[model samples]
Target: MKSIKTKHRIIKAVSALTALVLASGMLAGCGGSSDKDSEGRTIISVGSWPPEESDALTAMNERKARFEEANPDVVIEPDEWAFDRQTFYAKAAGGQLPTVYLSGFTEMPEIINSGYSSDITEALKNNGLEGMFNENIMDIISRDGKIYAFPTMSYVLGLAYNVDAFEAAGLMKEDGTPMQPANWDEMVDFAVKIKEATGKPGIVLPTADRSGGWIFSAIAWSFGVEFMEKGEDGKWQAKFDSPEAAQALQFIKDLKWKYDLLPASTIINAEDWYRSFAVGDGAMTVVAGDYPRRVAKYGMTPDQSGIMAIPAGPAKHVTLLGGEVMCIKNDATPDQIDASVRWLKTRYNNELTDEYKTNTETTTENAKKDGQLVGIQSLSPWSDKAESLVWYRDYIEQNANCNLNHVKLYNDFVADCPAEIKPEEPVC
Candidate 1:
């Protein structure tokens, strides 16, 4: 195993931030009225609160306490109301949404057009966060030159593999690094090698719950396939049926039939894919950037995980970029909006403020204690010059518990041969 204390080289900062923990930056608790409780402080309800028995709840509460102590006149009422497409509109229509809540980046346009969220342009400017965001991220949460949400984090897709499986298959380099696939073609050969040596499915592709289409899109993009484009009249056009898409789909078919590299089962969803990869039944899977918490839950040790760039195709290399944003409810009062901004800043500010330090320290300590893996690749919504980025890197390095070689491999790619980042297109 690689030393956890190995010095991590300074890599080019990617577009995402390391997901400190799933429940850390986005804090929510039991849903409640967005009004003053027993006290006179203005209540700002927010979502993504951990369950009562979760270790994360204690961390959330600690953050809540610190936030309350800092902003005495504002109170934060946590909620567990995660965004669900099916239930969101009903909640919005019933005026039951939290003052500030986590939402998908793609949902912003709909939420804004439907008047379900507040325009926080002025609030962002007021809080010294106006210039922190990457412009591409700004576009996602903005409409008509006004900002409505704050992008907390972003991620790109990559090939996450079982380190031990690759070694068992004699796929490791002399320097103890995994022999990562460089292109889709090489991925096939590598899959065959792993299967022949380890007697396990070499790679898994998700096929159920629409993830089959989702994964295929990335592979298609690598093969130089554009799924959609605007016509001369400005109407959107579908282009996914091109010959390149057929080639990509054919590759998947060959994996199952010609190569016999995929699992025997015909059905595999995102959940099953992660489970397979975690247990080494499937040696590799496409994973969104960051340490995979779900894989860890399925019993994979930190030392067993490794991530590399998504294999390129004939035309180019690309990865899908996506993240979560914080949206304020449309009807929130000025005080509520201002309070929400203050609260959000604590989660994603560029300055090395006391609040930021406390939040990071608390989250890191709690994650360490919870038997979680620390330090993985991520993209940040903030600019490259965000001062706190340096602090965060040092902190993670000092406290990292995972095998640093894996982190080095992923970060080295981000710093060296980073894939072209493409934002996800909206579904019509």
Candidate 2:
């Protein structure tokens, strides 16, 4: 998860009318510009939302500087415009989109169908990156043989838990390691033990908005439920109303209503829940691989936390894969589109070139200097499974900042998990 800090302060609740006015003001200011600068260089904006003092923000600035040096005719504009559901469409319709914007893999179909993204098939082919992407992920941005965006990163849902709390609860094995639960029942039992022993909430399950549904889909899929399935006619239809889905929902409801495994609030968004977990308020929660970076910002050390694969269900284990895609605005000129693609390749997709190796080395060295974790395992969008594994091996060997044993369970799980990986829901 990307860390975007928000300040908390006590204030009187706003009246309904005032709230509406505030919302209107927010929507009214969603526009951005893409005109040439005084120097006559085409301005190509990129979207990022890194915390002020984070290594990520520093890396992004460095990349922007390098991009500008390489493409002097184009000026790189750094926009702090992270993806927001409420303002996205308004910005797109107003021609205020950054030249390159980040979007969830699940949002591509809707963005493409709504004519918000440019067709980048020819651009990718021209750059020889058409065949570089993992086919499974490429399909997320491709429709009828036209590509709309480039997949930048991919992730799977997993169980993030506090090691100290688990040990206090005697949830660890005799070998001084976490006790890996094999199924949903064992997981619930373990959560109960952690709560009884630590006097803290057993687990936090986000039940608020789209995130609740997203995490629930992972559980539902693990329960052998396919929320949406392709019919014989090749059209997608909702299948979430099945018994398996009911079982999954019941499990979550039991955590809150019956088991009292969650907090009293009963509804928590992703950021709030992650904060709760980071501060050691809860023992476990569902999260992606990059969650540790967020936890670190909250003062949690690497040894204090660990991640494991989602527990197996009655049928088998499955994980829902999701990630971000880099897209160009539909209104971009041909030159702007080419420059955007070139920027993307230089920054993210240069893995096959010698420049990429040098870049990787430099990034690892810099991360070491900045005290950043170098080799946290994550799914790749540009390479197939085999190639990704090879890349990861070399990367960890040269760049790992933490002990691999800290997340050994997660590593083992990813290595042994079934190949039947499921993608996010296709219906936008």
Candidate 3:
């Protein structure tokens, strides 16, 4: 019989909002030229612009046109440069970045300390967006009481499992729900069953590009391991050299050697891990709540996959929080910052206006029409009380395309444990 547990668990509080950070290369001028365009509009370069062949480009251009129509003095120049750890530094150092661009939420420290991101507190205030964001998310991008970036989306990690694999392994219940692991030990047994039935790797983890370490931390956390802690001398000390951490590491080792649940290649990157899981090379992988959209393009159907809270460890049931943010360039002129703030508000469809409402409706409708996954649950960047969130929530419910049964466990855990959600280690 497939063993099922009633208790749902989630990660410690690591609050973040997930948005595409739009950063310009260091070489690109916030306004490529100080002089106005022939039409006398102030030009602002932005990143996360879809490629010419992308399906999202049309929607992006439409939003840009509307923003320009509403604010005639500003012109939005889209840059195709994307955010990556390696190229980000190259762009920042070379001065080719845009006026405002995309970046991960965790990169705030490096971006701000390196002087790549501008202080947008006053700009946010001016735009009436000062107190609109979730405070916990805002905290991640703020330093010394100053806000540096805008939180756009939020996410928490969950274990994504292949429904087909579960059924094939006889791990599915009569009600059509897969029998999920309640703890890490059960996860191993479940993987063994999956491997025996499917003749495929039962679980996958990224082992390259520091993704291995990233995935390791969550596992270690669940084992009651603290990567760091303040000592009596008031200095933060590395604490991972503990029994709990060793157990976590040993668990991973056994997954490969003893249980033989890992893939043929151990050197997987994050992208590879996701794609592998999507294509059914592995029965399960850890992913964020919004990761369904990412795997969708890989031909993973909604009914074929489901997400549940990460299996609990001996010490606790916890996961990692991650997301993205948008920031202004440090060198952007004040006028440029103001323009960027207005543009950001418009781009995110967060402003409280009839025009914004129409834009939101249109965007959601378009996603639905395109058969894009419409309703994977995500944390709101705005506060719970924000009117924008209310409508946005309603719209998601009304247009959701994915199977809610697939995501109910993770979503339910999130709804039930607001206080338990915690931030990840800053250095990771």
Candidate 4:
């Protein structure tokens, strides 16, 4: 809880201005027909995320093209994927958000809580997609007892380890090959080896005054503890003071301090988690499932990196579920909602997966070839990838997402709370 010190409530509203959400930018929603369809259906406006051309934009362009050719009268307006938490909040607060916007599974609470999204519980029920979604995504979007957004894709967390490092540290197979540690103790031992030999930080989180608390939150959750819980009154209440919670927090702190594995500086921005792991400055890093896939672009091969479930905590092995999702504005016409659904159906189709799946699957394959991962969707495609990527196949059953169960009450908690915990800044 040591990240953003400012409150969403305190944010000075950005007057209406367009913005992009992710690295890839937005994809157009429909083909040439972004207005009325051949049969005169109203043009529907949609937003794309990661804003640039990757598999997503390409797949979108292809699908939107087909959707337009099939229905000449229906125009599709695929706006840039610019809206994110702050922008979404601003639009919701000002009521300027689009009829349809896309985002992640973890974003549901913030979306609905801000009052811009509407419950499509009935629509989902009618469309037979009600059962197709995972409970985690549905739970996050539900507010005042209603479901808001629909899931688009799913993803989860895993431990990305260096295969060579594991062998070099004597933590791998007899052949000094790839494998994951069975528990936390062995995990920490390997980190120490990397530190002793490499003279680099063991595992990176964040320790800067303005960052580093996300690692704490994820670790705490992985131990089956929710740092905050909703009271009978339904408002979010901080719960990081429990014995188990304290133990989990202290264990990580000790790793940074006493054990000399996690450097105190590892406690800064969540972004460091990427740099340290991707650059091979750390032997092991617990991160999103997409970590190895994304790092492949940077030349971190499979033989050098691999992924596996985080070691089981004393309580349980856990991961924070995350991924993109779709939501239509409450005020949108029925036509808008239908159009949003049309786009979602197209994006999630197996045919589309054949196109987009490679972003991850291809990366996974490459990582595996170099010893970087087990397999993106192979671990438990039924549970982990089912409904989407959070579970992939069948990696885990019970998840720690959804608004009611245990969601981050504040976006900057990772940076701010730790600042509160010790008050003293790191020496570095």
TM-score leader: 1
RMSD of every candidate to native, in Å, equals: 12.5, 9.0, 11.3, 10.9
The per-prediction tally of clashing pairs is 10, 0, 31, 68
Which has the better TM-score: candidate 1, or candidate 2?
A: 1
lDDT score, candidate 1, position 96: 71
**For residues 1-428, what per-residue lDDT tens digits would candidate 2 score against the true structure?**
11112111111122344466677785343334345677878778888646487878888888788778988988887788888777787667656678899999888877887788999889887977768876657678888989999888888777888888898898866554577777778888988999889888888878878878888777877777877777899667887778887887888889878988887787798877877887778888888877866666667765677777778787668787899999999999887888889898887753555666666678667655543445556666765533434765677755566655556677666655553567788772
- Give the per-residue lDDT of model 1 (tens digit) for 1-428: 11223212111111122233223654233233446666788889889888687768987888789889989998887889889887787667656787888898767766787788898988888988878886657778888988888889887778888888888888877565777788989988888899988999998989888677777778888988888787899556888878998898898899899999888886998888788888888898887765467777777777787787888889898877778899999889888988899988875678887778877898787766655567764666877667787788778877878766666666666545468877676653
Between candidates 1 and 3, the lDDT winner: 1
**Model 3 C-alpha lDDT per residue in residues 1-428, reported as the tens digit of each score:** 01112111111111111111123224342323572578777779889899796658987898899889999999898888778876676556545678888988767766877778999999989988878887657668898999999888777777889989998999887666667688889998999999999999999988888778777878889888888776798545787889998899899889999888998887899789888998888998877776666777788776778887888888888877678899887878888899999999887756567876787778777655544456655666787657777777777777667666666776676555432455667553
What stretches of model 1 exceed 4 Å from their correct place?
Answer: 1-41, 51-54, 228-239, 353-355, 358-362, 365-372, 415-417
Ranking by TM-score: 1, 3, 2, 4
Q: Against the true structure, whose lDDT is highest? A: 1
* Better candidate by TM-score, 1 or 4: 1
Arranged by lDDT with the best first, the candidates are 1, 3, 2, 4
CA lDDT of each prediction against the hidden true structure: 0.77, 0.75, 0.77, 0.55
Error of 4 at 235 (Å): 2.7
TM agreement with the true structure for every prediction: 0.81, 0.74, 0.78, 0.68
Sliding window of 10 residues with minimal summed lDDT for model 1: 7-16
Candidate 2 — which pairs collide?
A: none
Candidate 4 lDDT over residue span 188-269, tens digit each: 7778877766776556555554334544555676565656666799667776677788888788778777787764355445
